[model samples]
Target: MSSKVYTTESGEVVYAMVAEFETPADVYHAAEKVRDAGYSRWDVHTPFPIHGMEDAMGVKRTILPMVIGVVGLSCAGLGFLMQWWMSGVDYPLMTQGKPFATWQAFVPITFELGILFSAFTAIIGMLFFNRLPQWYHPLLKKDRFLRVSDDRFMICIEAGDANFDPDRTRALLEGAGGKHIDLVEE
Candidate 1:
């Protein structure tokens, strides 16, 4: 049979292929198969968390913690430098006969700066990494996808994946016991 392509009303483009599953276990195993098959641009949705889903999906650790650590350290260093320059080099203030550029005096501010910067970095990094503040998505247009918040589980393989072929992807979903397979359009 000839391969059929789905398009938007304006003939825009196909977004992804969405498949429904009845249980978390079904979706979890399906995710493993999709991952092992070397499809990178795919995701699973379920009503509740499933244990070991990350391993099944081959999801790697996020770099947010690394980013936060780096930013926190850098900010702390800057805070120390600012205090040193102001007290020792810039202002040259002599307080209570204590030597200027006193290391002890900078500890609190340095720690505070590190904590503050780390907290901010965590928030911003999370938003950036998650691609958040996205008010709209093509998947929201699929009525069946709304069931994901209820009892249904789903997997969506994006058309952007290099290995994505309409017929083969559909067949793969079918083989994985995915039902209500539909092509979403952008």
Candidate 2:
């Protein structure tokens, strides 16, 4: 059968395959299996994180924090240079003609603006990369998925790459012990 590709509200491609599980353990195990299968964009939704499940799923930490840090540093540096260049180097206005290059005087303003710029960049950069400000997800359309925040646990693998196979993937989830096994079509 031809693969069904789903586009989420975030404009991300997610292959929708639903699995029903009787227990959280089953859900946890299924998530681990899904990850080991090498599906890149995958997620698990459980009432809570199951112990040792992350190891099983082979999940890796996202680099978004590092990206945020670099961008924040860049903003801070730019802010410092802009302030210094404009106030001291570019347009030298003599208030009392104390000193053209006053590091002490510049320190307060520079630090203030640097922190401001860095903080702003960290927030904006995170939102941009995360595609946040979202109020809802297409998963809300799945009745079974609603249980995710409650008693039920779920793992979803996106069809992000060429490796995604809807039919075979569904089979894999089922074989891993998924019960409901619904197809989420975008």
TM-score of each model, in listed order: 0.85, 0.67
TM-score winner: 1
Q: In candidate 2, residue 155 scores what lDDT?
A: 68
Off by over 4 Å in 2: 1-15, 20-26, 47-55, 90-97, 133-137, 159-168
lDDT of 2 by residue, 10-97 (tens): 7755546667676777877787788778776667777776787768777666676777667666766676677668878999778787
Please estimate how well model 1 matches the true structure, expressed as its whole-model Cα lDDT.
0.91
Q: What stretches of model 1 exceed 4 Å from their correct place?
A: 1-12, 47-49
Q: Which candidate achieves the best lDDT against the true structure?
A: 1
- In candidate 1, what are the lDDT values of residues 44-74, reduced to their tens digit? 9888879999999999988899999999999
Candidate 2: lDDT over CA atoms? 0.72
Q: After superposition, how far is residue 47 of candidate 1 from its true place, in Å?
A: 4.6
lDDT of 1 at 1: 18
RMSD (Å) of each candidate, 1 decimal: 3.5, 5.4
